[model samples]
Every structure is written in C-alpha cells, then in structure tokens.
Target: MKASEVMADLRRRFPNEPEYLQAVEEVVTSIEDVYNEYPSFEAENLIERLCIPDRIFSFRVSWVDDKGKVHNNMGYRIQHNNAIGPYKGGIRFHASVNQSILKFLAFEQTFKNSLTTLPMGGGKGGSDFSPRGKSDMEIMRFCQAFIAELWRQIGPDTDVPAGDIGVGGREVGYMFGYYKKMAREFTGTFTGKGLDFGGSLIRPEATGYGNCYFLLNMLATRGIDIKGKKVAVSGSGNVATYTTRKLTELGAKVVSMSDSGGSIIKPEGFSEEQLDYIFELKNYYRGRISEVAEKYPDVQYLPGERPWKHVKCDIAMPSATQNELDGDDAQALLDNGVIAVSEGANMPSTPEAIKKFLAAKILYAPGKAANAGGVAVSGLEMAQNSQKLSWSAEEVDDKLKSIMKNIHEQCEKYGKEEGSDFINYVKGANVAGFMKVARAMMAQGVL
Candidate 1:
C-alpha cells in the first residue's frame, strides 16, 4: 500500500487517464488497511480492472435560451462499472461539469451504490450548463435538448439518472417530460420526479435524513444522543434543509445555516417558520441567504464567512458543495468543541480538513456513505418502476431509515477494527463497497 507502488502501478496501467489516476489514489488510500489485511487483492490484479471504467460517453448539447440564442454545452456519461446491475446516479447540471469530475463522481458512485446493497451500478451524466436564473421555458427547452441526446444513452433498464446540485425537482420534471415525449413511454426512466409521476414521497429529504440517521448510529455507539444538542449546518438546499429538519425533530437546535452567498447565525435556534421563509426565498424566489436577514431582522447574517466558523455546535454538517470546508475550517470547528462532522455533499471536506478532523478524533462521516440515501432511494424508485407499483410515503421513509441503519452498521463493522472508536468511515465505506463489486467482477470473469 505504499504510495510509490500505487502511483507506479496506476501510471503504468492508466498512463493517460488522469481521472483514473485520481480515483485510484483515493481508492487505495481508503482501503490500504484492506490491502494490508488481504494482500491477495493486489496479487490478483484487482486494482487494474477496477481503475478502468466500463464505458464513457461524451456528447454536445445545444440548446436555445429564452432570448433565442443557442448555447452549446458539453455532456458526459461515465458508466464506471455495472457489475451489480444497471448504471444508477444523478445527472448534475452545473457550469463546473467536466470529464474529470464526472469520472471521479461516477467512480465514487460505484461504491456509493454498493454501500446501499441495492442492485445498482455506478454511472453519472450531465451537461456543463447552469440552470440558475433561467426562465422556466428556457430550462424546459434546455432540458428537452439535453434529453434528446441523453435519452439515447439511458433508460430504466440501462442507466437511470436522478437530480444533483444544480438539478432539482423542476429539472427532473422537465427532463422526464421530455423523455416521455421523445420515447412515447410513461415508464419511470428517472427518479426525483414530481409526486404526480413515479417519484418517491421522501426523495427530497432522503439524503439529509439518511445522513442524520447515520450520525445518530455513530453517536449511539458511544452512548451519546442528539437530543438538545447544538448543530451548525451549511447549505440551504435540500440536503441541508432536510438535515436541519431531521436534527430538529430529534431535539437538536440547529442555530446556523448558510447558502453560497453568506452564512446566517441565529443564536436562539432557527424556527421552522424562519426555515420555511428561507426556503421560500432560496428555493421558490431563487434569492440569496441575505434575504433571510431582511425578512427576519432577528437573524444575523455574516458576509464572506462559513457558518461553521461563527457557530459553536455539538454537531457540524457540511451539506454544501465539495471542499467548502478546508483545514482551517476543520480546526475552527474542532477548537470550538464540535463533536461530530458528517458530509451531506460529495467530498465536502478537503483532504487536509478531513485529516485535521481525524487527528482531533472527531466523529467524521464521509459523503459517499452518509449521503448515499438519495441514490438508495433512487434505486428503490427504480424497483417500484420495474414492478409497476409505488410505495406510500411512510413505507418509503421506513425503508430509507432501515437502509441508513444498515449502512451505519456496515461502516462500524469495518471501521472499528483498527481500535478507532470514532470509526474510519472512509475505510469502512471503501471496503464494504469494494467487496461487493470485487466479488461481482470476479464472478463475471475478465469483462
């Protein structure tokens, strides 16, 4: 598990694939303990096969905006691996889309899907087109254009896409509508659809609620509870909002929340009414977090700062974008006596930040494992689609809760072996995910 050995092998095998290189590095780092434990994984050349994606598709999406100006965007679909089943992941619509990021996400999705123990493979697709501030008609046009090409590459039995960062319920609805029109099928080819369609009831809250469920399990290991604890959460989107709601429901006082523009600190705790108003501005009105301060003068808004820095909390959840919390932020949270950190977004913490949290012995949960709920529920959606039946909201929520608990147990089972009381979630997630795919690959034999 030496870095030199890993780098050498990776370079020799995937000389031109930098995405493969980055992914291999992360996978190796996460499961170095597993390599040390087994050694045969290296001997059998499993790393080489796992490093290469099963398939990669890139295309151009040309759409006309409301102004009748045509815009060109790059689209990607990386089917990282399909050993378990069909490709399953979200289609992110952001200006930051690229092959490297998609490859990394698809690679990560492989394990994330595996962690759910569902019959799903790993794949992701999207365009480098941002949907922010676009008119509903413009978005619909863009979605239609995007799906015109993407529909040929995906389906219910082949690859299914849900919503990601810039993609939401509205986008999903548009895309699904376009797919239905183009394919002349009412089948469920996507998740996160409107409830009127095949969408699950708790899909919006799945990721955040699942993350809290995992954190609760982590705390339970030490006989700790979330009741009456203080929490600071970043991001006002679905993940952060739902995390706040679930935490509040569990008797936690979430005093801080933020958006991309700025952070809001309410020392008295954020009321559900205030949160609903914030959601109204951000989600409905598509405004900034500063609007929260304007609406409720009681809430103090801090400009140009992360919420974690100003709030002292027992739990800190970075549900924001990737690497939003860095080393300094981790140190600040640790110094402020934050007991636990769970990522509700992919790779929300930088390597240095995670190292700092680990060094401080804080309970940290990585996004791959903690935020798998969205994809897990997506898999469930797929099941319902295939079975031509829809589960009730309560039933879906019960299933989601059970899956989160199982994921936590799996993490603890593998993470506790190294005498780390807090659990090495990275190791746990990677090992658990790797074993399932590894076994499937072995059974498939040289594909």
Candidate 2:
C-alpha cells in the first residue's frame, strides 16, 4: 500500500473532515512499510477498512434549562473498531466536538488501546453541548437526555463511555445515573465515575501520572533524571492538574500552565497551596487560569496565549486541545532548550510542529502513547466492574506504571533504528499498534 495514494483517496472521500484525514495520514505513513510486508492484509483491503469507522451514531439531544428554555445539541458516538474487544472511549461535552474531531479521536483510540495490550476497541462519543456556564440542573438534564437516546446502544460489555474535557466526574455521574435508570442495572457503563459508584481509585490521575512515567522512561534512555528539571505544562484540566502534581512529586519544577483564556507563568514554580487554589478555581468555581496571576504577585499571566512559546523549560507537555501547538511553538520550545516533549492531549501538536520535533531529534512522544494512560485505567475499571471489586490506589497506580513501561518498550522495539540511538516514538507507536490490530483483524476475517 502506498501512503500517498491512500491519503489522496481519503482526502477525496473525506474532503471536509480535516482532523480525521490528518489522523489517517499519520498512521498510514507510519505503518505503510510494515503493512506491505503482509500480502494478505493488502489483498483484503484492510487499510481502507481500518481507516473507516465500523459505525457512527448521530442524534439530536434536547433538554430544558432551569429558565424553561429548551436547547438542542448534536450528539455523536463513533464506534471505530471492535476486533480486539468491546468499544471503549470517552464522551466529550465540549461545543467544539463534531464528526471530524470525534472520528479522529476514535481512530487514535484504536491504536492507543492496542498499545495497552488491553482488550478494548476504539470508540468515542460526545456532543456539541458546552458544559461551561451551564447550571448543575441544566447539565444534569442534558446528560439524561443524551443517554435517553444513547442508552439502548451501550452497555457494560458493549460500549463503555468515559469522561473527557467538559465531561468530568459530575457529568459521568449524571450520565451513569440515567443509564442505570434506563438499563435497570448498575454496571460500569461509564468510567471516571464518582468514588461512591463503581469508579476505580486513581482513575482521575492516571493519564497525567502515566505521561510523566513515560517521560521518565524517555529521559532515562538518555541518562537524565527528572529532579530539578524545569518543565512547562499546558491546560488546567484534569490532565494538566494531575501532571503538575506528579511532576512536583518527582522533584521537577513546573513553571507554567494554561487554559483556554490564557497561560499562567510562574518561573519560581507553583507551590502545593497554589495548585490547590487552581484546582478549586477551575473545578469548583469554573474560573480561568488568569486568576492564578491575580492571586499571586510572582506569577505572570499571558492573556489569550499558550505556554509553549512563553516559557523556558527542560521539558514541554502540551495538555491542551488539538493543534494548540504549532511550528512556531515547536521552534520556540527548541530554542528555549527543551530536550523532550510528551503529549497529554490528543493531537495537541500540529503536523508542522511534529515535523520540526522530528527534525530536531528531540525525544517526542505522541499523544496516543503518552495519553493512553487514561484509557488504560478505564480498561482496568471495566475489569474491576466485572469482578465487583475495586483495587487499592497503590495497586492501580502500580499497574498503570507497568503498562506505561511496557508501552515504552514496544515503541523502542519498533521505533528505534537498528544502529541509531534516537527513537522515533511516533512511528514506533503507530507501527506497533497497527501490527497488533492488523493481526487481529486478519485472524477475525473480513466482516
């Protein structure tokens, strides 16, 4: 299979779905060489089959607000592939969600799940409903209405939806409650649940902690220690917050964090008390990251900006949304003496940014490998739900670390050149994940 031909065809077919097209192009470019080695896979048109989702469910969700006003939103669930196991992914409630974004996410999730060695197929569901500024009652009503139409298609053993971005613990709980009512059974239909429910311990911190663990492995390959290393982290959501927490615990100095409003730069690094305030501001008060600058005299807030080009650090982690970092940001980070970059958000770095990183020979770990921790823990949550048991925080954390280490090993195996010290983690992750799913698909036969 030629990468250019496949991408050209995809572009013609999905002319408006830029995000999905970009994702497919990246995976195909990485796995093209390895894919050609299997004649049967090419003969069966496996590449085309894998590029497209197994199914897509789109519907209108209408709910009444507290003011007696009705609002309508588009909801979607992209069930990409299930050759490995059940459909598993997150439910994002941001206004930015659409078929293109969700398709890209679901496609990335397929390979990400395969890297975990877990029995999970790729899927993603979300709506264009923004949870920001919405009252609790309004959000609850929306969640119920979302599941009211979607509940019939999902189950504990079928598709288990987790939380992402606008969908947090509160949103997951709301949806789980509605699903329980409709299904007449309390099962693990969703992850990122409240602790009182069937939620697994450390699930919230898994992604951030996992990214840090993966970064440590990357640093170790070059004989570097994380202690006292200056770092810049973007996004103040769950991933960034927990990544900051874990980095602090590892003795790294995190100098910056950001939100959609802007970035907060603390060259002296943030204290535990400051982080707590940030957590409260974003999670409870729904405030912006600029508040951090106002509260602390030492910190500087760059309104309407990201942290990538503003902060100087040894490591950079883009935990924000897709394409937040661009070629200019990549150059800025490289010029500022950044040695490594680990992604905490899906497709946060643009193609140009990724190209520059590869050219610079910096240790760059893509989102699929770096952010798989969140879904890995979600898979564990599924297992716990099936057994009617919850593991201790330490146990879950240990397993998460183990999974991250194994993922790193797989990347090295496929990404490292036979005689070179540099590892192309992007290519490695894509090829490794693709091989697994390709084999499974081949064994299962064409559907």
Candidate 3:
C-alpha cells in the first residue's frame, strides 16, 4: 500500500482527528517499503485494519463531590489491538483526553509494547476528567464510579490499565480498590499499584530511568560520555522529575523543567536538592511549576511559553504533552545548537517538528522506543503478579536497563542507513514494531 494514499484515505475518514491521523501516517510512512514487500498483507488490507482500533468502550462516570454535588464525566477504553498479548496501556484523566488523543496513544503503545519483546498488545483509555483541585474523597468517588462501568470489561488477562498524565498512585489505588470490589476477586488487573499490594519496585522511576538509559546507549555509539552534558527537559511529572534526578546522578546538568503555568529555565541547572523540593512542590503541594521560580533565586519562569523557547542545550527532552514542541520550537532548538532529542511524553513533537529534526540529522528518539521503560516495567509487573512474587529494586532496575539496551539495539539494527552512520530511530522503531505486530496479526487471522 502506498503511504500517501493510505494516509489520504485515513484523513478522509478521520477528518478532524489530527492526532490519530498523524500517528497512523508516521508509522505507515516509515515502514512503507517493508509493508510493500508483503503481498498477503496488501491482499488482506492489514494496514487499514491495524490503523483502526479493535474496539472502543465508551461510558459515563457519575460521582458525588465532597460538597454533595453530583458530577458527570465521559470515560473511554480504546482496545486498539491485541495480536501479541492482552490489551495493555494507561488510563489518563485530564481535560484534554479525547478519542483522537487516546487513539494516538493506543497506537503508539502497541508498537512501544512490541519493542519491549513482551507478550503484550496495545490499548489506551482515559476520561476528560481533570483531577486538579478535586478533594481526595471526590477523586475516590470518581474513581469508583469510573471503574464501576469499566471493571466488567477489564481483567488481568483481558485488559490491564495503568496510570497516565492525571492518574497516579492515588488514582490507581482508588480505581483498583473499586475494581477489586466489583470484580470480587483480587488479581493484577492494574499496574502502578502501591508496594503494599502487587506493584513492582522501581516502577515509578522506570520511564525516566529508562529514558536516560536509552540516551546513554545512543551516546555510547558515538563514544560520548553523558557526564557534564547540558540538557533541557520539559514537564514536572513522574517522567520529568525522575529523569532529572537520574541525569543529575550521572553528572548532567538539566537546565529546564515545566508545568501547565510555565517553565523554569535554569542555566545553572538544578541541584539534586532543588529537584527534591520540586518533588514536594508538585506531588504534595500540587502547586504550579512557577513555584520553582518563586522558591529559587536563580530560576526563570516563562509564563505561557514552553521550555523549548529558552532551550540552549545539547539535548532536549519534551517530556510534557503531545505536540508541546512544534516546528518553530524545533527550529529554535536547532539554532541553539541542540544535537539530540528524546521524547519522554507520547507524541510530544508534531509532524513538522519531527521533519525538521530528521532533516537536520539530529540524534532523535521517539517516545515509543525511548519512553517504553514505564510500560516495559509494567510488563514486568505483570510477570511478577503472575508468578506471585516481587523482584528487588536492583533486579527490576537491571532488567529495565537490559530491556532498554535491547530496544536501542533493535532500533539501530533496523534504522541504520545503507552507507551513512546516522540512524533514523523513528523509522527503525516503527519498522521493528510493525513487522512484529503485522506478523502476529497475520498468524492470528482476521480477528
């Protein structure tokens, strides 16, 4: 199938859903040549089927707030594909959650999971329910109501949901508790559970830690040391905070971190002590990232602008939301002597930005390959729950590092140009993941 023709068809069908269309386009374009070699796939129209989700479950969540007021929110679970294994992905709870966004996420998750060499397929679910400013009781009520409708459709072997943007340990606890009550048997139907339960150790830091590990692997190919490298990172959430912490441990200066209100561009980089304060500020106080500037004399907070605007580092990690970095942002980064980018958030860069990064031949890594650490660890969580045992922090961390190295190797193997040393990791990751899923789908028949 022609990549342009397929994308045009998808665009016609999904006119206003730019996110979903962009995801499908990226994958097909990268692997178009490989896909063309499979005549049976073309005869069966596997590309089209792969682009569409297997099923989408939509429902409403009704909850009572602390003030005795009732609220309604829409919930969704897009079980995109399960050719490799059970449905697996995170459930987000933010005002921005929608079909297009979740569809893109699930599509990315499928390949991301495949790259992990785990027996897992891709899926994504979430609701447009902002957890911000909600009381604990209110959030608990909402979680319960959300799972009341979702529990019947999910199980350890059916569909496993984990935490995402607005859903964290607290939200997972509430949802898991409600699911246990509704389903009547306690099983590992969800991940990111509290350690008292079946949650895996190092799961919280898996994504960030894995991202840094992947970066090390990429840099190692060029014999570059990570120490003393100036970096810029976006987002103040689990991925960003832990990534910053890991980089600091490796002697890299992370110069920026941001949240909804704005970003903190610190030319001097953040000390480990400073990151600890940010952890409390965001995880406990639920305060804006602007608070970092307020607390620190050396930090600069740029309201209404992304950290990419002020980035002057060798590496940029857009760990925030989708499309947070655009073409202009990418150009600004390139002009500032940026040489590498590793996405911590799903689809953080737009098509235009990705084009510029590719055109400039920078060492770029997409979220699916670079940030699969969280889900890779989640896959480990699944295995531990199945074995009825837990691994030590060191064991889990070693396994995560190995998995990331393997992912980096796979990308290199598939992404290397015929004569050039530069590797197109996006193309490598997409092709590597697609070949696996496509073969799996072909073997499984038309389900």
**Highest lDDT against the true fold, candidate:** 2
Candidate 1 wrongly placed segments (more than 4 Å): 1-3, 8-24, 36-40, 418-420
Local distance difference test, each candidate: 0.85, 0.94, 0.93
Candidate 2, residues 102-158, lDDT tens digits: the string is 999999999999999999999999999999888999999999999999999899888
Q: Show how many residue pairs clash in every candidate, following the order shown.
A: 0, 0, 0
Clashing pairs in 1: none
Q: Please write out the lDDT profile of model 3 over residues 1-447, one tens digit for every residue.
A: 999999989888889888999888899999999999989999989999999999999999898988888899999999999999999999999998989999999999999999999998899999999999998888999999999989998999999999999999999999999999888988999999999999999999999999999999988877888888889999999999899989999999999999998889988788877889998887778889988888888888899889886868989988989999999999999999987899999999999999999999989999999999999999999999999999999999999999999999999999999999999999999999999999999998887
Candidate 3 weakest lDDT stretch, 10 residues? 266-275
| Clashing pairs for predicted structure model 3, backbone only | none
In candidate 3, position 19 carries an lDDT of: 93
- As for lDDT, the candidate ahead, 1 or 2, is 2
Please rank every candidate by lDDT, starting with the best: 2, 3, 1
Q: For residues 1-447, write the lDDT of model 1, one tens digit per residue.
A: 564687797688657666546555767787766666666666667766676678889888888887889999988888888999889999998887887778778888999999999999998888899888789898888889888887877888888888998899999999999998888888878999888888888899899989998898888887888998888899988888888888878999888888777899987688889978876776677788888888888999998789878878888889988778988889889988988988898878887888898777778888888999999899888888889788998998899989988988888887774544667777788888888998888778777
Listed in order, each prediction's TM-score against the native is 0.94, 0.99, 0.99
